[model samples]
Target: MGPKVIAFFLPRPPNYPMPFVDVGDDILLDILALCDVYTVIAVSAIDKRLHALTQTKQLWLSLIQDSTFRHVLELRPPNNLELQLHSTRELVDLIKRAVIGPPPWWPGGPSSSRTPSYTIAFNTGLEIIHDYRLLPGARYMALRGASAVGKDLVMYEVWTGRCVWGIAKRTLTRFAIDVVPGGTTARVLLALPTAYVGGGYHLYVEEVDFITGTSSEVFRLGFATRLKSLIAIVGEFLLYSLPSSDAEEKQVLVNWRKSTYVVLNYGTETNSSAILIPGYIVASHPDTSPPYQQLFTVTELDAFAPHWQPLTTISLSGQLFPSTIPITTQERLEYKGRPLGEFMRTHVRLSITPSAVYRGASTVMVYVNEFPKPRPTPTLTAQMGAFFRGRRQPEESARAALLTYWLKPPGQACGLRLVSAQLATPSFNTSPLTPPRAVLEHSGSSFTVSYYQ
Candidate 1:
C-alpha cells in the first residue's frame, strides 16, 4: 500500500495484440442507428465481436419500433400466454377436430350440384350472384344479416322506406323495408336482392368495388330475397330457427359438405360462451379464374369447443362487424378468457346517427356475401328511452341533471346526452353529490339507456 505499485496491472501484457481500437460506445450506438433492424439482430448473434451490439438496450429498443417486426414477434412467440395448448403438426387440423368434432363435411369437398345451392347463415348474411341469364328467369330466395362483406362488387338490397322502381339498364323494382332482430324495426339500408323473378326487377341499396366484405347476422343462415314477397320467402324458410327463450346454443346440422357453417343464438347464449363463425364463408363460388376462397378459424387451447374435429380452424376475427367490434375469437386470440364462438350473439343493436333524426325507415342490415334478405313487411317500431344520473328533477320534471353514458360507434363521438332539468323549490334540499340516474351503454348498434326517476 505504501509503494503505490499497480501490482494488478499486467505491465501492458508484453504485446497483447495491437492497441484496443476505440469504436467508442457512442460511435457504436450511432452505427447501430444506421443499420437496419435485420442487420442488427443478425450481427448481435455472432461471437463477442458482434454479439456485444445487442448488449446495448437502445439497439433492442429501436428494433421494437418497426411495426412489421413487432407484429411478427407478437404472432411467433406469443408471449404472456396464460393458457397453454398442445402443438400439432397441422394447426388447422387441430382446430377442425376441436370445434366440428364429428366429420361434418366430406373430406373430398362439396358434392356436385345441379342448380347450384349455397349455404346460408343467420348471423353472417349470405350473398348469391346470378348472371344476367338467371336474373329475370330463375326463382330463388334472398337472405342476409346487417351488412355485406367482400367488395369490388356492388350488392344492393331494397329501398328501406316506400316502394320505388327505376330503369337500371332495364326495369328494376325494390321491396320496401328491412329484416332486423326487433320484429318490425328497420335499418337505414335494406338488403338488396340479387335474384328477380316473374319479371326483370332490381333494388339499389349500395355500390362497391373488390368484394372483400363480411359481416355477422343472428341466424345460422342469412339469405336475401329482392322479391316483394318477403313474408312468403321467410315464412316458407325453415333452414334457420326462430328466436326462442327455451332453446340451447348448439351446432345445428346443416351443410353436407366438408365445409360446414355453424350457428349460435343470442337469446340462448350463457356466460363465458361465444359464437365463433369463420370469415369468408360462402356457399356459391364465382365462375372465374382461380377461385379465391377462404374459410378458416383458429381456436385457443382453453377454447370452449365441446368438439374438436371437423370444425377446428375457424376464424371470425376478420369478418365485418367482428373486425370492428370486440367479438369472440375461436381460441381467444388475445387470451381474454373466451373463444370467438363463445363471444358473438344473434340479435345485435347498433347506435347510429343520420345527422338528423331516425325519422324515415333506416336500416342496419347485415349480410353474408351480401345483405340479409329483408322482411317484406316491417311491423315493429324502434324502442327508445332515456335517463340521467345527475339531473335534478323539478316539480313538473327536474332542476339540473347529468347523464352518464358509455357511447358506441356511429354516434360515439356525439356528446348528446338525454337530460331534463328545471329547478327544485328553495325549500327542498338537494345536494350536488346526488349522481344522475341516467346510465347508457352501447349494445350492438343501439344505445341502451337505463335509469330511475
Candidate 2:
C-alpha cells in the first residue's frame, strides 16, 4: 500500500556490524568450517543468522569428516542416527564431550569398576536367548533365539529399542556382523544349514545387507553335521573354524568378495577361541596352564593369492592368572556342644574371553574372570544357607579383571605390549545362584562390562 520505500530505509547506526550478516551462506559456512569446533559453536551463539548458518547439517557433517576423535566415535557411533533427529546444539555438544573424554560415570570410565553407571533392559520376546552381540559403535544390538524355528535374527536400536530389521523362518547357526565405514551399511555373514538332495546337510555362507535386508549366497561348503562352528567377518575377509577329521580345529580364512580361502594350521589346539579383526585373526587357548594368544596376519602371497600366516605369539602367563587369591577355610561343628571341624578345599580357575579390538589403534581387550573351583555338590541345608547369605560365601572368591594388550605396530616388534590392567571385585548380585554372562564393550580408551542373567 505504501509508495516505493527504497529511499526511505533507516540509516545504519554508528559501529553497527552488518558485514557479518551480509555474507552468503556458502562463504559463511566455509569460514565457519575453517574454525575449530568450539570456535564455530561460540560463533553460532553470537547472532541468529550465524546460528542458522552453523545449524546446517552440511556444516556439522564437514566437521565430523575431519574429526580425529576416532576412539570417541567408536564409543557412540552414529549408526542409525539421522542428522535431522538432532539439533545443532546437540551435535556440537557431542563433539565437545568427545574432545573432553568420557565422564567418570560413563560405562567405560573408572566408575564402572565399582558399579555400572546405568542399565538398559532389552526384551527379546523369546523365553530363551542363545546369544547376542552388541554391534560395533554401541548403536544397535543383534540377538538370536535358542529355538530352531520361528525367527532367526532381530536387530534393534540400542537407545529407543526400535526394531529396525529382522529375519524370520530360518535358523542362524552362526552369524557375525561387520558395520562398514561411514555407518551407512552393515554386512552380516550367516551360516545356514540346508538339507541336500541325498541326505547330509550343507552350510551356506549368506551375506545380508543390513540396510536393505536383501541377502545373497556368497559360498557353500560341506560341514560336519554334528560339529559346532563359529564365524566372524571383518570387511570382506571371513574367519571361521571347523572340526578336522582328526577332531582338531581347523581355522579357515576367506575373502568372500574374491571367493578365495586358505586353511590355517593352528597346530592342534582344540580349546582355542578365535576372533577376527580387520587385518588379523587372534586365537587364544585360555584352558592351558599359563594360556597363550597367537596373532595371524592376512598376507598376500602374490597379486592373485592371499594367505594368512602366523605373525607373532604372546604369552599371557602372569597377566591372565591372578597372583594372590584369598584362601578361606570352612568349619562345620558336630552335633550337641561337641567341637568338630570340617575342611573345605578350593583352587582358582581362570577363564578369558577376547572382547574387542580397536582396529586402527592396534589395541585388544580381554575379559578375565577368576573364581575358586566349586567343591562337590553341597547338601540341601548348605545350599539354602548360601542362598540366604545373599552373596558368595566366605570360602569362595570371585575377581574380574580387564586386560588390554597393544599389538606391535608395523615394522617394529613381534609381541603384544601390556598397556593397562584393571582388576575389580566382581559382584554377581544380579543372578546369585546362576553365573551371570558378561558383556564387554570397549571404546579404545576405556571399556565397560555389563552382566546378564
Candidate 3:
C-alpha cells in the first residue's frame, strides 16, 4: 500500500563547546599554518593548549618557509642562521613584529609627543638649495643647491654626521633626486643636465649606488622647458611633471628599466599632486575607486564638493597589500582652529604630504598644513602702508604644521586618528636659503627624520 519509506537520519553538525581545540594536533597545525604571523601570535595568547600548539617547531618552521617571511629575512638578513634555526620561536616573533608593525597608540594620548629627537643645522654660507631628499633606510640625506657657477649635490650620513658623498659643483641647473626603497643596495635616481639639443635642454637620469657612490647614465629626455618636479619613483616607474603654457599639465611616467614612458593628463581645473609612499602611488582624482581612500592632492572646490572634507583613511594600494583604514582628522585640527563656523569665514588650505608609511605598521608620519588664505604675502606696497600707519607689518601667518596619524584596525570604527600636531615654529620657517621642511629617512628599526630650519 504505502511505499516503504525509510526514515533517513541526517548527521547533525557538531556543536562542541571547543570544536577547534577538539581537533587533532595535526589538523590544528595545518589550520594554524595557513594563518598569518600576527594571527598565530594572537591565537597563541588565548590559552595554554593553543599556546603550546603554536609554539611547536613544526609550526614556526612552516612560517619561516613562507614567501613573505622569507623576503623580510632576505631584506633584513639575520645575523646567524644557526641561531635562528635553534630558536624558531624567537625567529617567528621577530618576523611577526616586522610584518605586524608597532602596536597601535591612542590619539591625543600620553604617548604623543611633538618634540624632535635632535636637530642638525645646515651650513649657512652655501648657495640657495632648490630641492632635497632623504634616502630610504635613513642612512643618507641628499641636498641639491643652486649656485652661479653650477649646481652642487651633497650626501651625508645621519648618525655619524659625515659627508659620505659629494658632487663637486657642476653647471647642471635643473636637478631632482629619489632613493629606491628597501635593502642596503639603495639606488639614487639623479636627474642631471646634459648637452643642449633641439632648441631645448637635454636631461639624463643617472643611477647612483648609495653604498659605493658609483653612477651611470640610465636614459635621457629632451625638454623644451625646465623639469618642474620629480613627483615620485616606484619600482621601475619614475613619475615627474613639467611646466606648460596651459595650467593643465601632463604627468609623465618613465620606466628607467624598460626605457618606455606614459603620459597621464588630468583635466583642467584639477590641481593634482602625487607622492610615492612605502607601497602605493597616491593621487588626487574625483573618480578614485573607494570614496574613503585618502586624497593627497590639494584641491579648490566648493563646500559641497566631495573633496571638501578630509577623509578618515590613510588609504594604500600596491602590488602586494591593498587596503584602507579610517584615520582621525579632527584631533589634528584642534590647535589649528575650530571646524564649524571657521570654514565659512576663511578658506582653509589642507595639504597632506606623507613622508613614510612603514611596512607592517599602522603609524604614518605626514606633514599637514591647514591655514587660512589668501596667505598674506608681504608686498612692498603693504610694507609702505604699514610704515605710514606706524603699525607692525602683519606677522606672517604660520601655514605649515607636522602631524602624525595612527590608523586603527577594522570594526573598531576608529579611523585615522591624529596623535600629534606641532606648528612649524619661526625657527622652522622657510626662507630664501633654507626652506622650512622635514625629510624622513628609514633607519633599520626607526626613522632618522631631518627638518630644515
- Among these predictions, the greatest TM-score belongs to 2
Instruction: Give one digit per residue, the lDDT tens place, for model 1 in 228-302.
Output: 221111111111222223433222222312323233222232221222111111111111122211111222212
Ranking by TM-score: 2, 3, 1
- Residue 13 C-alpha lDDT in model 2: 98
Assess every candidate by TM-score. Answer: 0.19, 0.47, 0.44
* Pairs in clash, predicted candidate 3: 137-442, 138-442, 312-327, 326-415, 326-416, 327-415, 327-416, 328-416, 328-417
Indicate which candidate wins on lDDT: 2
Candidate 1: what lDDT? 0.26
Tell how far residue 388 is off in model 1, in angstroms: 42
Write the residue-wise lDDT of candidate 2 on 259-318 in tens digits.
Answer: 555555433444334566654555433221212222212222232142323322211221
Lowest-lDDT window of 10 residues in candidate 1? 132-141
Q: What is the C-alpha RMSD of each candidate to the true structure, in Å?
A: 25.4, 17.4, 13.0
Quick one: ranking by lDDT, best first? 2, 3, 1
> How high a TM-score does candidate 3 get?
0.44
Indicate the residue-level lDDT of 46 in model 3: 91
lDDT for model 2? 0.48
TM-score of candidate 2 against the unseen true structure: 0.47
lDDT of 1 at 405: 20
lDDT of 3 by residue, 220-249 (tens): 553432456666665555667755557454
Q: For each candidate, what is the lDDT?
A: 0.26, 0.48, 0.46
